[model samples]
Target: MRRRDFLATCTAAAGAAALAVVRAGQCAQGATSEVAKYAAWRRFADTPFGRVAYVEQGTGPAALFLHGFPLNGFHWRGSLERLAPHRRCIAPDFMGLGYTEVPDQQDLSPQAQADMLVALLDRLQVSSVDLVANDSGGTIAQLFVARHPARVRTMLLTNCDVHENCPPPQMRNSINAAKAGTYDQKMQRHLDDPVYARSEKGIFGSAYMTPANVADAAIEYYFNPLVASPRRKAQLNRYLAELESNPLLAIEPALRRLKTPTRMLWGTADPLFPITWANWLDQALPGSRGVRRVEGGKLFWPEELPEVVADEARALWRV
Candidate 1:
């Protein structure tokens, strides 16, 4: 049997005994060549977390993709586009935020995000998989391995918190943001505040700043999600709650000890996660490389420059 089929068959059997019936089916589904070959809405049952939304495609060893704050699996479409041909790629929106909803879901903490990742992987019937995480996805990736070291094979960390010794630009903004009361209010202040006024423009510009490419779609696509619900203002408030944990300060010590093979991918022009941490991590984390400095992009490089992101990530993973 093919490696994906052989492993998936074993994983499905394990999942059947470990996960609920629905989830086992999804794992079976994940291993299903006909089903996973196309873009389809997928659901898993009995993950440690509640029900979830997932998209899967291709075949072979799994490559699980995770997104950053305020964005869902949609953020991974571009990256998946390139990878689906050779690898089985799965991307899911974080719980309570995306197409998946857990109204009573409390504790939107980083640890919870990590826990959910483990459950999701188990339900999908993937024993071990590489990860592609961006921003907070990067943050959650560490917690995932820290919590379930056995599940993560290797990681491609892009502009994320890999080094506790260094602080990225967004971490500073997140701290400044918490004081603004509501999540929306803080980011609003971030956008409106004079300190970031020019930077905010860059944030949008980085989305589509190539020569002769004047596109506003990048900015619109990102901002439209916030306005998704007028009442979502309450939903927006939850992200700021992360402040109570001081996740960055808390996780910094652990980053230095990560045993996973990691690739620090950064956008050279990223205002949020400046390229400085690349060097800091290189000096601190053994075997880590400051590969391609992402050229001309924003915090949302996955969408804006998936080819660049994938090309470098592919090189890093040697996929």
Candidate 2:
């Protein structure tokens, strides 16, 4: 069997084991329990924007992870745990997302998000880092590298937005819904129907090849923060609006000039960021390390293929 296929099988087996543990109510205290593990490594940092929550583990060279929209640092928890032995994995919830505090007048545009990431790193006393970004986090990472190339030692990008594709057509429906100010109504619709929420047609389903493979608790971690309040909902809308703007056009020239040793770990099945975007990124970012494809991988590959993600980062940085 292919490596990813073998890994996927292993994950399925582990999920079954975890479910058995959950049934026995034995997952509440063990360090090996997914629930306990996710709860343990969390911390809050006071940044200029607000309080940012991050899941940090291991210690050595820093591998800062940036997650896409509607998801937060929790998205990288699996990879962080897997890679903790070799690298310090720091996954922070971007401003107004995850457990981070949302300001009433927050500016969550990609550029602002990138700036906040830089500042957060500064406050943490991390002078340099290797970036691992996916989804909207990929957009933010690119912008971060373009604006502050020196701070990044290397970068690994999974499927994400680039250039005019911004939000991409497949993702437009959700973005339009958010922009139309219908976040609450739509979110409630999912909350009301657990079956649909777990179906392939649901939020998690649309991104993951096997939605059932993801735990309900993990799904909650992605959606609960967005529906925390109307103000937070507005922040979500603001972030969607930024997607429509041609934000990357301004930085294209700088990106083409970048030489930061970039690597691509693309999910072949992602509708939003098709394989073509991987080619676009490989060429656009002159620091291109090359592209690595994950067969049957979808948008939320980090959540599903943590070990592969870690291997790619290790390959690029020689960690």
Candidate 3:
């Protein structure tokens, strides 16, 4: 090869490599900016349960987003950014999770979580909301719909507990640890080790699509407050232990009788809550529009694929 041709090819390769590096840096910067934005958006609403921490954006009819276990309002950060232009987006950290402050004797049962949501909406003067939820939040969403059928304008449910499958078989070990008062210790280990937090033994591996790709900053943001102190650790355990009871069984009748328009978005790959449960929800709810299968999506797909959440939500809300 000619010397001039060799030089030209080498220069071109270096330029391409440099451009790739710049693009990668830009993506990382964008994610960091999003995390910072969520931190800045945090606000607290005084409810009977506690000073409920939440993030709100946009201006229009209200839309409530409920997160999964061990996750807070930040779970819906991507969806919130996308849907803010269409409706008022509110995502609150439930008691025993995230930044919500609860009284020393506060109940962390699913029922209490549902009631806390009521208190929160009332505090915000939001009479009704387009509800969106995932994991344990979906369980609370059902209870909320059963108790206050008139309050939910429309519901969009992702992979979550349905009927008798409250805690699921896979979570039995964690619940047992909670019952034995060792679950909090396990959480502490996760907090101390980011690599483990994203490993097969931790939440990221079990719930997320790309466990290793999860940001360290996000892991800290989630687990830090949960294991912040002794009281916080106890509260975290209580939250898990409370899930042992089958609250959905009793609400089955009410769920069937419910007339609120609903949509189910299921992640087919989620082992904890299978697509079968989503189909069950579709069959049970009288007003169910149908189930939309998210192929290969795991339990926390809404966080990973916010465009899917926003698209389905817009279709359900008819906006």
Give the best candidate by lDDT.
3
lDDT of 2 at 295: 94
What is the lDDT for 160 in model 3?
95
User: Candidate 3, after superposition: displacement of residue 129 in Å?
Assistant: 0.5
lDDT per residue, candidate 2, 1-319, as tens digits? 9999999999999999999978645422332366556767778888888888888899988889999877888788778877899888899988867788857897888888988888889888898899999998988998888888989999999999888888788767777887888855665556666568767777777888787666656656577777778887788777776777767878999999999999898889888888898899898878898999999899988788889988888888886
Clashing pairs in 1: none
How many angstroms is residue 134 displaced in model 1 relative to the true structure, after the best TM-score fit?
A: 0.9
What Cα-based lDDT does every candidate model obtain? Answer: 0.63, 0.82, 0.91
Model 3 lDDT per residue over 114-144, tens place: 9999999999999999999999999999999
- The true-versus-predicted C-alpha distance at residue 235 of model 3, in Å, is 0.4
**Residue 273 error, candidate 2, Å:** 0.7
The local distance difference test score of model 3 is 0.91
Report lDDT (Cα) of residue 286, candidate 2: 80
State in Å the error of residue 313, model 3. Answer: 0.7
Candidate 3 displacement at residue 9 in angstroms: 13
1-319, model 1: which lDDT tens digit per residue? 9999999999999887776767646644543432234225555455656667777877888998888766567667778889887678998877645555444445567777777777777787888988888877777776776666667777787776544523344455654554454556533443344234224344343333441232233223333444456444444555545634545556555666766677777777666577776677666555465555777655667666788767866776686
Once superposed on the true structure, which residue ranges of model 1 sit more than 4 Å away at CA?
A: 1-48, 162-232, 251-254
* Candidate 1: C-alpha RMSD after superposition: 16.6
Using TM-score as the measure, which candidate wins?
3
